[model samples]
Target: MSVSARDALRMAALYVVLSMLWLVVAGRVLDHLFDGSVAMAVGSHLSSLIWVLASAVLIFITRARLLSFIGLGTRRRKQDSERLRMAEAVFDTTLEGVLVTDRTGLIVHVNRAFMRITGYQQDEVLGQRPSKFKSGHHGPEFYRQIYTSLAQTGEWSGEIWNRRKRGEIYPQWQTIRAIRDDQGEVSHYVAVFSDISAIKHSEQELAYLAHHDPLTGLPNRLLFNDRVEQALGTAQSHKRGCALLLMDLDHFQSINDGLGHTLGDQLLKRVAERLSHWLGAGVTLARLGGDEFGVLLERCPHVGEAASLARDVIEHMKEPFSFEGHRLFISVSIGISLFPSDALTGEQLLRNADSALFKAKANGRADYALYTEELTAHAQHRVETAGELRRALEQNELRVYFQPVHDLTSGVMVGVESLVRWEHPERGLVPPGDFIPIAERTGLIGEIDLWVLRQACSQMMRWQAQGRSLAFVAVNISSRLFSQRGLYLEVAQVLAETGMNPALLEVEVTESAVMDDPEVSLEQLHRLRELGLRLAIDDFGTGYSSLLRLKRLPVQKLKIDQGFVAGLPDDDDDIAIVRVIIALARSMGMQVHAEGIEQAEQADFLLQQGCQLGQGYRFGRPMPADALKWG
Candidate 1:
C-alpha cells in the first residue's frame, strides 16, 4: 500500500481510540458533576457533537493527501514535480519511437518521436491497435509468432516490416514488451523501434558488390566459380553432361589501349547487357575479369550442343555494337570443356577450357575450340619450354642470329634483321618459333629483346670497325618491348656503349604493336626518331593500322609480312595484298621491304611491285654474326 494510505489509516485509528476515551471519561464526568438526569444527557450529546466535528476535519485532510498521491489533486512534494517532468522529457526526446497500449490492446499514448516516424497524430492513433501500421508483408503466422514470444517471455524484439501513414512499407527493428501491474498481470504493452531501412539497403549493396563485377555489374570470377561448382554437382547427380565455355574477346587489348579506359569500362557494361540478353535458361553468364567471360550451362548433354551454343554466341557477337556514336566490331573466341568426360571438378573444367581457348586464339580468333588431350600436352610443353627459356636468357645461352635484308633491285646486302635463338646446352639450337611465343607469354620477351638489341649493336660496331658496307643493322623489337616507355633509353644506352652510329641502327616495331596504344606508341617512336635512328613498321600488312595514326608514325620502312609473300607471284590474294601494301608504302613515302623470299620469282615479283628492300632465304638464311665475312 502507498504511504498516503498508511498515514490515512493511522490517523483514523488514533481518532477512534481518542473518541472512545472521550466518550467514557466525559460521560462519567458529566454524570458526576450534574445533579439532575436532564443536565447529564445534555452534556453527553454536546460532547458527541464536538468529537464528530474533529473526525470530519481529520477525514478531510487525509482525503486530500490520498487524492494528491493518485494525481487527482495538486502535488505536495518537490521531488514528485521534478520526476514527472523528467519522465515526460525522456519520452519526448528519445530517438526511437515509443508507444503505449492499454490492457485491452488499444493504443493509449504515443510519444512525439512516434508521431514523427509514423506520420500520425496522437488523436488519430488513440484507441486504435498497432494493426493500423501493418505492412501486410507478414502473414498471420508471423504475428502469431511475435505474440507468442511476447506472451511467454514478456518481450519480442526483431526486424519487422511496418507501414507508414502514407502506406509505404519499410523495415524497423522493434521491441514490444508486456508491461504488467503490481499483481503480475499485464496492464499495458510498450513498443520501441527505430527505422532500419538505410542499414538494410547498405547490407544488400555490400553483398551485391562482393560477388559482382563493378564495371559490368555482372557476376565476377568468385560468383562465376561458385555457380560452376553448383552446376557440376547437379550434372553429377543427374548423370548429365555440363559444358563450361570460356570466352575471350579477341584483340580486346588493342581497343583498351587505343581508347581511354572510361570508354573501355562503358563498353564492358554494354557487353554484359548483350551477354545477359543472349543467354537462355540453365546458363549463368559472368564477367571473369578483363575481356574474358564464362558461361556455365548446367544441361549441355553433348559436345555438339555446346559447340552449337558457342557458334551462336560467336555469330551474335559478330554484329557491331554501337556506343556513343562509335560502331565497334568485336569477336569472341569460345573454348569449351565437357563435364565427366573432360573433367569432374570446376577447376579442371576451367583449366581445360582455358587451354582450348588458347588454341582458338592461336589458330586465329573468332572461332571455337574443344578441349583435347593434345592441347593439354601442348600446354605442358609450353610451361616446360618457358622455364628453360628463362634459364637460357639468364645464363647467356641465347644467341643473336642476323638475317640479311637486301636492296631488292640491286640484290645487295644493305642490312641484317637481328633475331634471337636459344642454344640450349642439351636441346641444341631452339628456333624462335618454338620459344618466342613461350617467352612472350611468360613476360621474358622484353628482357630477351633488350639483350638482343645490345648484342646486335655490339656486332654492328665490330662490322663498322672492319669497314663493312652495311647501311644499317635492324633489330626486331618484340611487341612486349615496343610498348614500354624505357625502349628509347635502353636503345640510347646500347648505342652509347657500343659507340655505333645511331643512324646505323634501325628499330623495327610491328604494325600491331604501334597500333596497340597509338598515342603512346607515337610518343615512343618520336623519342627514338629524335636519336637519329630509323624506325620501321615490321609485318605491315598483317596488323590492322589506322591510316590517320600510321601517317603520324616516324617510320622509313614497311616490311610486308612473309605470310603475304609465301605464294608470292602465284597466289592471287597474296599478289593483290602485296601490290596494295607496296603502293600504300609508296603513297606514304615509306620504303617497302618484302620478307620470306625463297625463290627468284618471289624476289622478282617484289621488285616488280616497286618494293625497295627485301629480306628472305633468297638473299641468305639467318646466320651467326661470324658467318657474314665482310672483311
Candidate 2:
C-alpha cells in the first residue's frame, strides 16, 4: 500500500481502540457508584448519558479528521485526472507522429498522426515491431548504429526511409527517446517522426536544375567541365587518349533573329536531341551555352575516331528539322582537341578546341577542324586586331572611303557609297573583310557603324559646302546597329549634329537585317522615313526576302549583290536573276543599283536591262573623301 493509505489505516485502528477503552472505563465507574434500584437506575441513566455524550464527541473528532482526509484525497485524484487529460490532448493533436513502444521495441500506443502518416491503425500496430514498417533501405549496420546511439545517449534523431502500410517508401525525420521510470530504468521508447518526402524531392529538383540547362535539359557548363576533368583523368590513368569537341551551329543567329526566341529555343532543344542521339556510349554531349555544344569522348583510340564522330554529327545535322510546320535546315561546325597533345587541364582543352572551332568557322561553315599550333597564332592575331580596332576611332586611324555611283544613262557620278577602312598604324590598311566580321562577332560593329555614319554625314556636308552636287551619300548600317532600339533617334541626332539634309543621307540595310523581326524593322524604318531619310536595301538577292513583305518596306533602292554582278552578262543564271530583281524593284517603284560593275560590257548589259545606277572599280575604286574628283 502507499504511505498515505497506511497512515490512514493506522489512525483508524487507533481511533477504534480509544473508543472501546472510553466505553469500558465509563461503564465501570457507573457500576461502582450506584447500589439501590432507583439509585442504580439513575446512575445507569447518567452513565448511559455520559456514554452517549462521550461517543458523540469521539464521532465528531474522527469525522472531522476523516472528512479532511477525504477532501485531500479527492483534490489529489482531480489533479491526476487533469494531468492525464492534458497529456492525452497533446498526444492526439500534435503534428508529428508519436509512438510509445515497450523496452522490447513492441509498439504499445500510437497517436492519430501516426495512423495518418503510416496508414496503419492503432490496433494494427499495437503489438507489431517497428521493423514491420522498414523500407529495407537501411541495413543491419544502420539499425545497429541507431541502437548504439540510443543506448548510450538515451535518445537518437535522424533521417530514415520507411515503408508505409501501402508499400510506398518515403523518407522521414525521426527522433526516438528512451523513457525511464523513477528508478532510472528504461521502461519504454517514445518515438516522434514527420514525413519529409516533399522536402527531399525539392532538394533533388534543385540539385538537378543546378547541373542542367533548363531549356535543352543537357548538362550545363559547370557539369560539362566536371565531366571533362573526369574523362581526362580516366584517360590519363589508362594511358589512353581522349578528345574534346566544341561545336557551334551555323546560321543559328539568323534563325533566332528571323523566327522568334520561342522558335529559337525549340531549335536548340531539337539540336540537343539530335546530337544526343548521334552520340553513343562513352561520349558526353552538353550544351555549353547559346548555340555551342561540348562533347567529351573518353578513351578514344585514335584521332580518326574523333574525326569520324564529328563527321557523323555533321551528317546527321544536314537532315531538315520540321518544327511548327516550318522546315528548317541547319549545320554544325566542329573542332576537336586531343588529350596531352593539345594541352593539360579542362580549360586549356576547351580553349584549344574553341580555337579550332574558330578556324573551322573562318574556313567556312559545315566543316570540322582539329586543333593545330598554327591556329593559336591566328587566334592571337585576331585578339591583337580586336584591341587595335577598339583604339582606331580614338587614334583617328579610321577613314571614310567613298566609291562613286554612276547614272548609267548619262555616265555621270551622281552619288558615293561610303565605306569604312581601318588604317592600322602597323598594318597600313586593313580590309573590311579582314576586320568587319571580327567587329560584328565582338559587338564592336555597332559603334563602328555609328562612327561611319557621323563621318559620312560630315563629309557630305563638307562636299555640299564646296559647291559639289551629289544626290546622296549611302552609308552601310550593320545588322546590330539596325536592330538597336534608338537607331532612328541616333540617326536624327547625327543629321542634326552634322547639319546635313536627311534626304541626301541614305541609310543602307542588308535584306537579312530587315527580314529579321520584320515588324520591329518596319516600325524602325517607318520612324526613319518619317525623318525624310532615304532607306535602301544592300545586297538584295543574297537573303530570304518575301516579295509580299517587301512591298510594305519603306525603301527606295535595291542594290544587286556583287556576286551576281561579277558574272554579269556571261552567266545565264546571273543574267536571269539580275533581270528579275530589276523588274521586281521597278514594279515596286524602287530604283535598282547594280554593284560590282567592273567592265563596260557589264555596264552595257545592266543599261540594256534598264538598271539606272551602278558602282564598281570600273568607274572608280573606293577612295578617301579628299581624293574624290567630282564630274
Candidate 3:
C-alpha cells in the first residue's frame, strides 16, 4: 500500500532477475554434468550455493524496508486497544460529575462522580432522561431559556438545583456543551456539574448579615432603602401610590440611661418583634437606626389608609413592655410621605417623611402626621433657623433678660431668672418659644447655652460689685447642652471667670430634662451641687415629675409651671394640685415659687397657700439687666 513497499517489491524483482541470470550462466558452465572430474562438480555446487545466499540477502533487505514503511504509515490494532483502555481510565477517575446526554437531553453516559454526586449507580442513569435529576426548582420557561441559549451559543454555564437518588434536592454549579457530528448536527450534550450546597448556604448567611440588623434580626437601613426604591419604581409604573412611614421611639434614651444599653437592646428586639407581627406581611418594617424604624407600604390605596395604619402603630407603641425585670413604656411619632405626591425618589421620600416626623414632634409627640406642602416649608424654615442660630452664637445675637423673683413675705427681691432672647436682624425679636426647641434639635443649643451662662454670670458679678447683695442669680440650663461631656466643668469655669460665688450661681432645669436620662442627669446634678452650686427644678409638675425621682434629686427649689397657676381659683384641679405641690415641697425642705401671678387674686391665693415666692407680669415683665432695681 505504501510507495516504499512498491519500491521494495520492484527491487526484489530486479534482484531475483539478476540472480536468475547469474544462476543460468553458472549452470551453463556447470553443465559439465557430474563427470568423472570431482573438481568441476564441486565448483558448480559452490556457485549454486553462492547464488542462493545472494538471493536470500536481497529478499531480507526488501522485506525490512516494506515492514518499516508499514509501521510508519499505518496503526496496529493493539495500539487502538490501549487507547480505549486509557480513555476509560480517565472517564472513571475524574472528580467532577460528568453526564453525557443526546441532543434531546437524554442521559447516554455518566462517570463515577455522577454516581457519587447523585447517589445513583451507572445502570440507573444510563438510559434515563436528564430531567430525572431535575428538582423542579426551575420552571418550564427557565429550562426553555437555558436550552435556547445552548442551541444558539453551543454552551451554557449556571447554577441549578438537582435531585439526588436519596430524594434530596441540592444545588449544583453546571456547565453544558453541545457535542456536534461531522455534519454539524448536535449529537449529544455533555454537562459537567458539582454540588454547591455548602457554597449556597454560605452565600445566604452572608446576605443575611449584610441586610439585617444584628441586634434586632430585622432588615436594616440598607435593605429598607432598597425596598423603598423598588416600591417607588413600581408605584410610578403602575400609576399607583405608596407611603413611607418613619417612626422613632419617644423616651427611649431614658431606658438606656436608667438601665444599661444591654437592657435597651433587648427592649428594641422586643419592639421589633411587636412591629413585625402587627405591621402585616404587606408592609416592610425595618430598623433604620437607634430607636428609629421605617415602613414601606408598596401599594397603598390612599393617603387616608396610610394615615390610619400609622395611627394604629402609634396606638400600639403605647402598650407597656416588661423586659429583664424592667417595665418600659414608650411611644412613637410617625411621619408619612406618599409616593408620586410627596416624592419620586427614595431619598426624597425619606426626607419628606422625616420632615413630617419633625412636624409631628413639634405639634406634640405620640401622634401621626401627613407630609404637606407646609411641612416642607417648615422644614426649610427650620434649616434656615438652624443656620441663623449658629451664626447668632458666633456673632452674639443672643442677649440675656433677667426676670426678678421676689420674696412674697418681705415684698423684696431674692434672685433673678436669666432667660436668653434672640434678636434677629431681619425678623426683629424672635421669641424663645419659636427658636429654642429648634436650637435644641439643630445641636446649636450647646453653644448658645454656654454663651448665656457666661453673660448671666458676668452681669451678676457687675451687680454684686455695685454693692447689691442678692440671694442668688439663676440661669436656665438647656437640657441639650447639659447632656454634653464636661458640662459641669464648663459651668465652673464660667463662674470662676466672673468671680461669682458658686453658692450664688443656680442652674434651673426643666423636669423633663431630669427625666430624659435619670442616671446621667442625676450624676451631672450631683457634680454641679458638689461644685457649691444650687440646683432647681423649673416648670415643675409639667413633665415626668415623680415624687420618687424628686426625692433622689439634689434640688433646693420647685418652680411651679405657669400653666397651672395661669387659670387658678377657677380651676379646682389647678388649685388642689398647687396646694399639694406646695405642701410636698415644704415638707421636703424645698422652697416653692408660684410662676405667672398676674391677678391680685392669684397672688392672694398663693400667699394664703404658704407659697414663699412669686414671679409674673403682675410684678414686672422680664426686663433688661440695667432696668432692674435690686433694692
How do the residues 1-631 of candidate 1 rate in per-residue lDDT, one tens digit apiece?
9976897688778978988898898888887889887987788788889878877887788778767666653454566788999999999999999999998899999999999988999999999999999998999999999989988999999999999999879999999999988999999999999988899999999999999998888899999999889888988888999999999998776677667677777777888898898885557989999999999888887899999999999999989889888888889999999998999999999999998998898888899999999988998888899888878877999999999888888878888989888899998998779998878767898999889999999998888787786899998898778766788999999889989899999999988788877898999999999999999998888877999999998899998999999997899999999998989889989999888999999998888889988888888899999896442
Instruction: Give all TM-scores, in the order shown.
Output: 0.72, 0.78, 0.68
lDDT string, candidate 3, 1-631, tens digits: 8976897688768877897899788877776655556867797789978877877886688678768867865666568878999988888898889999887777889999899999999888887899888898899998998889997999999999999989999999999999899999999999999899989899999999899999988899999999999888888889999999999887676677667789999989999999999877888999999999999999897999899898888888889898767777889998999988999899999999999999888878998889999888888888999989888877878889988888888878898888899899899889998899898777778787888889988998888888887898888888777765489999989988888899998899888889887778889899999999889898999886667878998999999999999888789999999999999999999999989988879988898898998999877878789998756
Q: What is the C-alpha local distance difference test score of candidate 1?
A: 0.89
What ranking of all candidate models by TM-score puts the best one first? 2, 1, 3
- The numbered model that scores best in TM-score is 2
lDDT of each: 0.89, 0.91, 0.87
Evaluated at residue 241, the lDDT of candidate 1 is 90
Cα error of candidate 2 at position 597, Å: 4.9
Off by over 4 Å in 3: 1-210, 482-486, 516-521, 569-571
Write one digit per residue (lDDT tens) for candidate 2, span 1-631: 9987898799789878976887688667767886667987787677778768877887799889989988999999999999999999999999999999999999999999999999999999999999899999988999999999999999999999999999999999999999999999999999999999889999998999899999989999999999999888888888988899999998687677667779999999998988787676667889999999999988777899999989988999999999899888999999999998887889899999998998889888799999999988877878888888889877889988999999999999999999999888888888899999889878899999999999999999988898999999999999888877699999999999999999999999999899866877888889999999999999999989988889999999999999999988899999999999999999999999999999999999999998999999999999998888776
Worst 10 residues of 2 by lDDT: 251-260
Q: Of the candidates shown, which would achieve the greatest lDDT relative to the real structure?
A: 2
lDDT of 2 at 205: 89
